[model samples]
Target: MPDRDVRPVRVRLLEAAARLLADEGPRALTTRRLASEVGASTMVVYHHFGGMPELVRAVIVEGFARLAEHMAAVPRTADPVADLGRLALAYRANARANPHLYAVMFGGVPLDGQAPPAEEPVAGRAASGAGTFGVETFAAETFGVLVEAAARAMDAGRLRRDDPEHVSAQLWSAVHGFVMLELAGQFTGGAETVLTSMLVNLGVGLGDAPDAAARSLRAALDTPAP
Candidate 1:
């Protein structure tokens, strides 16, 4: 055969690298080793990814896409505050579901250092039939959601009339810090407990009365059995 193909080979190499990186740490990722692990020629990995740094970055991007898949799956509610809590819990669910990806994506990876290479969206988007959401872009979108929620609360005369940007930042920091720390194995309890605590803190800042947020939560919990 003149040549069966190399594109498939390159894709396999990337898949192998992703799996290994998920199972092993960054220290275990090497182009040569990855080639061996994938049963492909070293040239294939090098040709496909350019170099180790590029390959590592690709993995990081893929990991973020996976995280986005989990986040995107969180149900959007008519109640923005409830939507926020659901998103928070969904974040924890993603971490628990894919600890390996979570570890690499959030553990030691630096997303803000440099922009990721523009390439295919990755497995999650293709599988889910949805577009990829960059981490920063997603953060911005989530921030917008928080701002809308804050605005709603204020209009209802629940929350104080303050800067939505400031309140949004504060609330984002609270939820992100909690989830990030919990994923880093800093918390002792299960995700549900962590979620409860985070939602309570979020409510304090976003809801009129703590009870107002709590009632919404209680209703979610007692969603009609159908």
Candidate 2:
């Protein structure tokens, strides 16, 4: 007899759902379709996730978890600004690797003919509340990584003494905009050069000495991210 696949049902379901979404887009992810893909019954999804919305929520949460792992893997050096830039590159890499899922994760792609929740609740507030499943919690946690990095830079006197949250939000906006444009194929020339320039400029604006920060950013870009 053949050996059995012993993975948890929830894991199997999430994997199938991710593949379905990646291969065919969100519209292809239905309970029946996921069940068929995983060689299970629709009841399995219900048993694990309660319903399609919750399952979709799980998928988004899983994407953020992977993203956080990728960012966290960046080695922290004396330069916090450079560290933040490394995290931004990790963010872009994650999106590039998971283009289809990236859309669903941030572009507000619908699932099962229903749109995702409009508002993102604060992380760790309440999971039982509507739209408060792992979705908002994981998303917030992922963003928190950037915020905390900014705080560290501020404490080290490498960045401007502004609100860390605000600083992170600005950096995030710049990185996300560039990434979105890159993913859209708007970059006719060297996107990495542009990204590095923007990051260097951001570092200068923050508080770092312009010459040293730019040199560090250029050097950091030389080291390829995993």
Candidate 3:
């Protein structure tokens, strides 16, 4: 006879939830549906996450955690701008690979305006039983990776002497805007070409020498992401 799967219930629920969220939108994440997907009873969802709101929050947290892992894997080089550019590429790739999860992570449409309903005091305590931190903490920590990279670039004289937070925010906005547009089918031309142009422009705008920064970014793009 085939062996019974023995993975922990929480892990199984999370994996099933992620797949369901990706395939169907947030609305499809009913407790019954999750339980059905994972071949478990509805009590399993409650036993693990307390309720749907907590489960959805967990899914978003897991998504950001994966994104952070992808960005963290990017190798840091002497060329901070290039490194930043490569990180941007990685971000785009991650979003593409997990469009539905990405949407959930970034509060995209359908799920965009819908904030998770607050848990009742009893439910909150039950949810907190898992000892999970707030989602914003994870998100801020992930964003700090970019801010630190920007600081490194400025310190190395590769970029202009600007507030690292401001620089990081600007770069993030530009890259994120492009990714959103591309995902929405707004780009008529090659998305990669447009991305390269945008990165080059960003480097030129912030770097001490326009030519050197552009060359460095172009070279960075040529190298495969680690």
Local distance difference test scores for all models? 0.59, 0.76, 0.76
lDDT of 3 by residue, 1-226 (tens): 9887698777678767766765676687788988997789999888877877777777677667667877888888888888898889888878877676676767773553235555344333322344544566557777888998899988988888999999989998998999889887898989888998888888888864778777877877886754
lDDT of 2 by residue, 1-226 (tens): 9888798777667767776776687788888999998789888778877777767767676677667777878888887777887888888888887665576677535455645444444544432223334666667777898998899889988887999989999999998899889988899999978998899899998888899778778766765664
TM-score of each: 0.64, 0.78, 0.81
lDDT of 1: 0.59
Which ranking of candidates, highest TM-score first? 3, 2, 1
- Error (Å) of candidate 2 at residue 99 is 2.2
lDDT of 1 by residue, 26-125 (tens): 5667777888876777887767667775665555555566556665665555665665555555555666665555655554443333334554453443
Q: Compare candidates 1 and 3 on lDDT and give the better one.
A: 3
Model 2: residues >4 Å from true position, as ranges?
A: 1-12, 15-26, 111-133
RMSD of each: 7.3, 4.4, 4.3
How many pairs of residues collide in each model? 0, 0, 0
Clash pairs for candidate 2: none
Model number with the top TM-score: 3
lDDT of 2: 0.76
Ten contiguous residues with the weakest lDDT in model 3 = 119-128
